[model samples]
Target: MTQQGVSWIDKLIWSWAPESFKEAGESIVKNFWLHWFPAKVSRRSLAFNYSFWLGTISAVLFAILGVTGVLLMFLYVPSVERAYPTMKDLDYVVAYGWLLRGVHRMAAHLMVAFVFFHMVRVFYTAAYKKSPTGGSRPLNWIVGVLLLVVTLALSYSGYLLPWDQLAYWAMVIGSNVAKSVPILGKKIQFLLIGGTEIGQATLIRFYVLHCVFLPLIALTLIVYHMWRIRKDGGLACMDQMVLKSEKERVESVGSKTYSLLGITRGMEVNVLTSARAEEENLIPSAPNLAKRILWVTLFTMFVTMVLAILVRMPLEAPANSAVAPNPAKAPWYFLWLQELIADTTIRLGRFTINGGFVGGVLIPGVLALWLALWPFLDKSSPQAAGVWFPRERLRQNVVFTLIVLGILVLLFIGGICRGPNWDFYWPWQPWPELPMHF
Candidate 1:
């Protein structure tokens, strides 16, 4: 494959074929990859440096999870009676099933981490702030945040699938937290569990949610998120130039304009070498995209495989509604909230707020709302948009960094430090024995 718009595959298949086939291949290649991603990207914005390609890494992980998850579905039947045994079969009976499940589980975890890293990268780079001429980036930022939420939901829903003590108690704690919401909490719980308690119905409900509904929604949102990245302009960094004037914008777009009536054939569309383009710095996406995606995919696969081999997915005793774990915990991602709820209460003089409502509902809701509205609220300089940790953006950066640190601290506490009765314990402390189910 070369920038002249011919691939080795095209030649292999179409060398003795019709010119129409060749032309078709060229057109598709031109319109698909090269059209959106021009020959030139900011040298700084290249995957070699600016991004570490976190977004691409996250996407690759999602794909890996999707493939492995589908394979797992064939073996797993979501029911109280069948779930745990099926998990054992996946590990011991099915060929390479443990590997598949392991990869899926690890990829899901990697995606969660990568998504957060991507958000941090976007923020420190000021990628979510407004562009010149006030074309805001907040819309895409909001979409990305929602994508993150979808990701968490996906992982949490899947957590219950093994139907073990870990899954069972986690669901109990998570659902009870949902039930603590001021109103509509019970309805939300019902929608999630399909009943008042964890049962065959709950497993089936979570099964569909994890395997079908959430994934579909996640894929749709992810596609939209990527589209918006292209629409808003690729990775914000030093390499991008803001189109300041309407004339510059039009000229920068070149002669290729889309119309409902259709683009006229035989019209000469100029290459994207408008007056604003820095031709010396531009490189074609043909080799770059291919190389980056391949490298990222391989790296992700290697890491996932290594993890899968070393740390098999855990399975505890099957769920029993009659017995509860000593200190039930939510999924690791939500441990921060769990810690907050366990540690504090809120009151406004005459008004008292339930700790669960404060930590699980109100605070998380406000934080999400704040994140969605941030682009509109901050009247920061557009010059700060592409730069990493610009001096002028110190205030916002510090604030976000503190928030992140606080969350990590909460996660550490909730995940490792708390033990029986949710009491504080050292990381090395032994857990109190609890009755096993099934």
Candidate 2:
């Protein structure tokens, strides 16, 4: 292209783009979506290693799930008789339906995983601590915990939509776990399945929870979670920057300070005295933060699409309430809990203690409560807020890491080591085949 043409193109682009930082800031203020983010962010907040961008990936996955889920809703019927057939139609008859379901399913699983990893990132970095200049971030941490629970609920609810033997048996196991609650167990299970059995009511209940109630709750929590991040002064790393700036200001009290009249010397001045150091590390969120988010979003979507095409979602035989699988298992995420229940069950000759109540209800409840309350319990120095595995927090970090590893070990055992009849077996061992049911 000629220089004249290039100049014309640049002019056209600049016409829409902000010509100055002031204009860019004003534009962001005026735009609804852009307004969610702060006008400027610290450079540290945008680095890939700082956050691994897991939170951004999670939001992208949620968006993908929303779009694909809405599309699937049009073709799916909540009725038990039609649910299985409709899934088969999605696989074979509908154009690109298989791809749609694959992407949705994969995104759902990935969202759960990424949300979890994001929480772990926050915990390890002590991001949930209060900022020196901002309000308590532990409140926002609680909101994040709620978001994780809702995410899990959304995934579990959707697991039954296929109405396959796998889905049916898994749900049966899940509802029974709910039934292990002390006094309200039966009531909760009834509310969940809508009756004494897993029939049409059960399907519709899960359908509604998965499609409507849970998604709306998740969306609300997500909005509050992001807004809280901004309200708490960007990311927790910004706290470290602010504290560093304060320390530097104290140390440099002896440095020369220029008066307003001395500006004529063409010397640079820190006019915004209090925020001078913070400003030095800040960059406009408009192009800098926006571009990084765009990159992460695109990368996540592309990978999800590739996986959707390569991996096939399973569709087992239609649900059979009568003939249960030899080892009926819950969803993979719940496998750890299942294993815990099995291990915790105690039988003393005549009396028995329900393992479901102990393992599924008590243990997880205590863990979740502890997780949500830990920020308040934490006694580390403020300097440790944004640093990963700081020496000051070594003991807590070790304990937390051990807990996470224990859950992973249980998950591996339940998913891989448990065979038919829920018997223990090595991964490489061959299992004796059972007679065909049909």
Candidate 3:
């Protein structure tokens, strides 16, 4: 009776003795040893793979953005009438407002960066070239490209909250450039302008788009994107997977001769096997997973905290529908393009050229085509599995590197050349320089 009572007491103590705390403490101890101990090493497992790792990072970033963005909206009022004023208040009136604004801005930038990096990672591995995600590449790439655009859109829309002369004319010139689109150009201009100029209507339109529509779509696509990652078998190479499936499907080649003849347990296997090799290069889960994820989360949170505290969000002056500000700068991100257009001068008699065609249209078209052609050109079948480097992979790698470098150069040239009013004018005018006190 005494021994049974002791055992029951032991069980009760184990069960109720702060399980969460115990688990957390265990994790901390294990991580510390794994992280810093000289004898530490990684233990590999297949719980989650590279695709999950990437999808997890993206999902985390999105979650941070969604939460932070919503909090920001509480302090933000999207109207020409109140937008600038609200920004000023967010800067000074609210507690930790600057921190939040900073968090919001920086988080936005990082999220965009991560999403792009994720796509590039997916491309290089040929994960998107095979079944599942491969079969769904068209839709996947569409989502990726649109995410990039939406990220830019959010950044641009936020630029106006500063309410400065710079913000006003930047929007004006930006809207003007959009109006340069072929065919539906005027229609877009009208839709944007509401009555043909940047005003109350424009502010409200941008506000809604930035705060609501883009975010909603981004969230939806993000979910679909993660699901695709799981469907694709955790970044296993397309060729590798295909090869494995085929070998399994036709393991014997219908050779009943071996069985019927009973030729001394004939077993000269024909199917290829890279299972051992594929399992070798994988990132381990137990320690590496916990460690990488912890760092990523910590880094992201630290960034948010720092931004929310140090920087102040700017709000621009009132919008003047009638007057145009001078020297309008493109959004810092797009200035590279505007600067390019500014230098597109000096014509050869009759034939003139514009840099916008090269910077805006041609470069983007070339990049889009290059990305689309990647699966076809990267002929190293993932189905081949664990064939890390084929005979002449050097040529393919070089081609890809050059293509990337070419795009970077074009964007760099474009960024350096672009500005307001075709790079000639300023966003701020002399009247503003004269200093009218409110």
Candidate 4:
């Protein structure tokens, strides 16, 4: 009787197990991972369930940056006057605070990298096709672009805090370059620097932008972007929907248009949507999404901690309005252009050009243009994207390649031809000499 009762208890436990741990009398029956299952989230996400873990990585990184930024905010003073010394103090006296700073920096870099990685993955999978549950690819592209911008802003703003040799010179270059804008250029540059040079005003403004504004915007966008992803998919596969018949296609159109907030031609036309609806469930659910989200978030925190402790980066001198640091260098990221414009020997025959246009102006300009154009350029029936090389590939490749080539050529010319002309020498060098048009 005792043995029979024990068997029944074992059977009961095995039946009750939540897809993880189970007891079969004397032996436990389950995979090694059964013990490590996660508590379910209210809303299941690829973050929680899936293995292709890009989005989860982004969320975890953002959390790290947010936590570290908040802590740093308490310690940071947004004053050119107090900023540099304050950073130095953090290094010397802030009780393991530098770890937070290091993690913040490293995470910012990683977030930028991950954004790029995410984009590549989306493209390769043709995941941008619109679906009922997951279709808003355009929104994803926009948010991704903004994420890159915020990453840049974070890097730019953070540099000013350190106030080091590299930092100071880089600011001078950035400010001067900004002044090269044709019309309101000087004014805009002045507004950013908060006066003529990198002073108390400039530092304070940067600190505010870096700590307050950019993060808020980036955070809001990421959340909104994710909500869009959920509304659109398992992962935006379109091929499953496209192969349906003409009758099915016509019916799907009016319904899809209304759902997308897209315009319709005639109210009289309504055919078939049910057949097309089956296309919604193409990509598999994010494998073990809950665990993925948890581990990714946890692991990023670990990485951030390691970066802070190991990196312990430095700060520069006190910002001085009076001193003009000669040979002012641009940030390493922007150095390619600074280096280009610095080349005075390559003159553009007659009109001495500024190379900053290529590094600072044209390349970034083209990148912006491409981001703006991607949705229209890539539009197609979701099902068609399954092909190895879609029929539309030729047109898109041609346009994309040409635009890319034009940008590179401009950068090359600007770098090679810019000389000691007033434009290159001191880009925003006070333009007092003016001709009131005759």
Q: Give me the candidate number with maximum lDDT.
A: 2
Worst 10 residues of 4 by lDDT: 35-44
Ranking of models by TM-score: 2, 1, 3, 4
Question: Over the full model, what C-alpha lDDT does candidate 1 score relative to the true structure?
Answer: 0.77
Quote each prediction's TM-score. 0.83, 0.91, 0.68, 0.66
- Which regions in candidate 3 have their CA more than 4 angstroms from the true location? 1-56, 132-139, 237-295, 307-327, 343-354, 369-380, 383-396, 406-438
lDDT of 2 at 174: 88
Model 1 C-alpha lDDT per residue in residues 32-68, reported as the tens digit of each score: 4334444445566674666778888888898998998
Give lDDT for model 4: 0.59
List the global CA lDDT of all models: 0.77, 0.88, 0.57, 0.59
lDDT of 2: 0.88
lDDT of 4 by residue, 1-438 (tens): 244454544433333223432232122222222222222221223422222567667778878878888998888777655667778777788997677677877887777667656655555444555554346666676677777677777777877776766667678878877876667778989998999877778878887888888888888888777767555543443334433444465666645555423344532233323432443332122223334455777887887678767775655556554554443455544544665455532567797665555546665767776775576667666664423335655565456557545645544444443333324423334434443221
Model 1 sits at a Cα RMSD from the real structure of 7.6
Q: Which has the higher lDDT value, candidate number 2 or candidate number 4?
A: 2
lDDT of 3: 0.57
Q: In model 3, what is the error at residue 306, expressed in angstroms?
A: 2.9
Q: How well does candidate 3 score on lDDT at residue 73?
A: 81
